[model samples]
Target: MSTATLINLVRNGGYQVRRRAVLTSRLLQDEKRPTAACYSSTSERRASRFDPDGSGRPTTWDTFGIWDNRIDEPILLPPSIKYGKPIPKVSLANVGCASHIGKRKENEDRFDYAQLTEDILYFAVYDGHGGAAAADFCDKYMEKYIKEFLAEEENLENVLNKAFLEINKAYERHAHLSADATLMNSGTTATVALLRDGIELVVASVGDSRALLCRKGKAMKLTIDHTPERKEEKDRIRKCGGFVAWNSLGQPHVNGRLAMTRSIGDLDLKNSGVIAQPETKRVQVKKGLLNRDSNIRTKGHHRYLMQVALPT
Candidate 1:
């Protein structure tokens, strides 16, 4: 069988989430093992017991508060299955807190895998500002965009640009539906990574929130932070009709609020010519390692590669 077909078979066998529609009986039965019935029953009972009202039944919304809900959540896997090659794994953790000045918590952050093929794992992190609408939308819809884009793309560079543009359009459409009201003013900062076969890592970023590559005890930044105070960023902001205000510490900010010079969702900022669009960078991890391939290399190099190869 082809790799794609094998992956589809595995997904049909219960390894993936069905996005187009609810899983049909035939699909479920093909995937289900005898133990699935017992596991499902236990899961249902657990969910019921955790229902807020103490009822024996739990609604779909109620499942959000429980950890077990992840089990039923859709799993994104690569279209191709690696034969004799182990699938690369990735793990991520994120924490977001409300800003001290805001009455409403407008910032939202998410890390999700958009595509998982045998050779590549595509993931992105979006940090929203101004309001939660843009960020929340990114969290919900960016992955879908990535998957759709990748299905038709073979080059990583083209895929990155296409996905980003799609995200931009999606945000704009969502904003326009509100008659150019509150949500339109909101925007997000994005940083994305494409991990390829433990050999190459490509990253793109707009605003802050960074991706770092640690190899052989040395740390290297994968993407530049687009801060307003930087000379280039400052010039760009000014040329775009945005003013960079400086603080006592000599740090620059846009409207005395944000520090970054680029982002995704800020329509108000974009109007001033400060784009939220990200700059992209690609790095070859294996190439770097090969360049420093020496017996005298520190133990940290091995540790770093091992850490990167295995998900958190």
Candidate 2:
């Protein structure tokens, strides 16, 4: 099997994206906190007590100690962030983001974007499972590795792939190396993109939080969901002695645990064929709205990748 697939979408094709119709809501449930990535610690389980088995680390931020380790506050962005430096006055744009708790007790979705320099930028979205620690850890530290790996002698693709893997290893089973991945029962999906000189776009992701681009009235999907139902993922899981099956209501689960097959953290499932390796892709944007474009967009209030309901 291919370890990774790379293509220049702008050159190979115009800007066509994989067109798949599915629910983003289903994706979010995998990040549900309190042990299993899917289902609430109480609600989803009592609703499905007849289900099989399966199942973040900590951060310096936890030192504040004013919070419950299990539940966390949602990242609520202010309107002030909508303003920033624009490339050209004619094409300048603003960025805006907001997070909503909705019916969930705490927000497991986390995101961050940083401008490395006048010509470079990085943006990432993380949907956390089991707990918010995985998202929090990756959100704070992945960029450090990305910057460190950028001094590489190879190319952008190699640099990004390695950077993602480095952090995955750093956070997975932290009982061995770092203090962050100790959240043995948690995991998080990452979708990251790097923009350079306003024309080059690079994206890497694990799990299903998607990256979508609307170009000239076309919806372009830049990432793939590493969900359990994917054939390759299923085969790998089974080969590793993990079983993939649908719950009574038709939701696919790996070893009856997580919905997505790839993510950072989730130490218990690593031996069962789960991995933190990400899918990396590059795009050359010879021409596009660089001055005003945002890194990614979420749909509705639940965010594009969040699940609306689970099988009972």
Candidate 3:
């Protein structure tokens, strides 16, 4: 398929994964032929995006098929994970981030937040490596899926998890389609937070973008960075037949390539334990600050605030 056609396929194929089996078959058989006539029949063209079970839609996520035996790793340029908006000098509830592009040519960071209700807000940050497609894909579609899942389940945690999974599934399917093949080489780290009534804060994180909560003038870290050097992450990668090595800078990387152990769309690295599942945490929000709360274990007035920074 032409690059345009592939990009179009990825653009239009969001979350519809049932036809992947047939898509692979077609790539192996038809992609090599010289003519547009390679796809012989109108029926075959119609079946390009299959509705396998006749419901005219993809089934649940378990059937999306993200795991495969193929790996075509590509060389990446210098990482530009650093980028932030100008500091707003406002409260965390109405926070402003300062982002600047470093020496690298491309900045692969994305951030957004939405206030759903007067008391409810959603915020997110993505740190992308390799390329921008994975991060862009999540930035484009995560909120929509979150809204859909939230409507069905009142639990915010379940909604966040389901949203991440659905976004990854959709991006993976797009990467492997006859078009948009270049997307596979790219992946990103995702960090999302939901704030309710400017009081409660819930965050879901994958990979190394950090989130910290400041309450009563003390800083309490809210999320863990998923670097490969972490014990559990190292052990998991080894179990998956992947190895870790440190770059000259003394930072450990999975398979000597990616520095993080978990992420949203590292398709080539999944067999090595890079996954999209977010480490989720919900902090109790008591309107009144205390000398100490059981959840935060600190003595202070109840003032919940956020501090978000890009990778150095």
Using Cα atoms with residue i matched to residue i, what is each candidate's TM-score against the true structure? 0.57, 0.62, 0.62
Q: Which whole-number lDDT from 0 to 100 does residue 312 have in model 2?
A: 10
- Top TM-score hit: 2
In candidate 1, stretches whose alpha carbon ends up further than 4 angstroms from where it belongs are 1-107, 287-312
Model 3: per-residue Cα lDDT over 1-312, one tens digit each: 899999889876863565786787777766565555365576553321234333334555434433121112221111111111111111234345545556558878777667654445677788777888988888888888887886798777888889888898898898888386668879988888876543456888898887766555566777888887689888989999999999999999898989888898889989888888999999854322121221222110111122432111
Model 2 root-mean-square deviation: 30.1
lDDT of 3: 0.66
Q: Write candidate 2's Cα lDDT for 189-217 as tens digits.
A: 88887766555678888887887654543
* Candidate scoring better on lDDT of 1 and 2: 2
The runs of at least 3 residues in candidate 2 whose Cα sits more than 4 Å from the true structure, single-residue gaps closed, are 1-93, 173-182, 286-295, 298-312
Per-residue CA lDDT of candidate 1, range 1-312, in tens?
899999889878664455434656555764563534344354343423356433344455545443432332122244113222223233332211222223444325554553366567666666666676776787788667766777898766667777777787878888887774988777777777776754456677777766666655566666667887578888877787888788898887886766677777777777565674668877654322132211111011011111233321
Q: TM-score for candidate 3, please give it.
A: 0.62
Off by over 4 Å in 3: 1-93, 117-119, 288-312
Which of candidates 1 and 3 reaches a greater lDDT?
3
> What ordering of candidates by TM-score runs from best to worst?
2, 3, 1
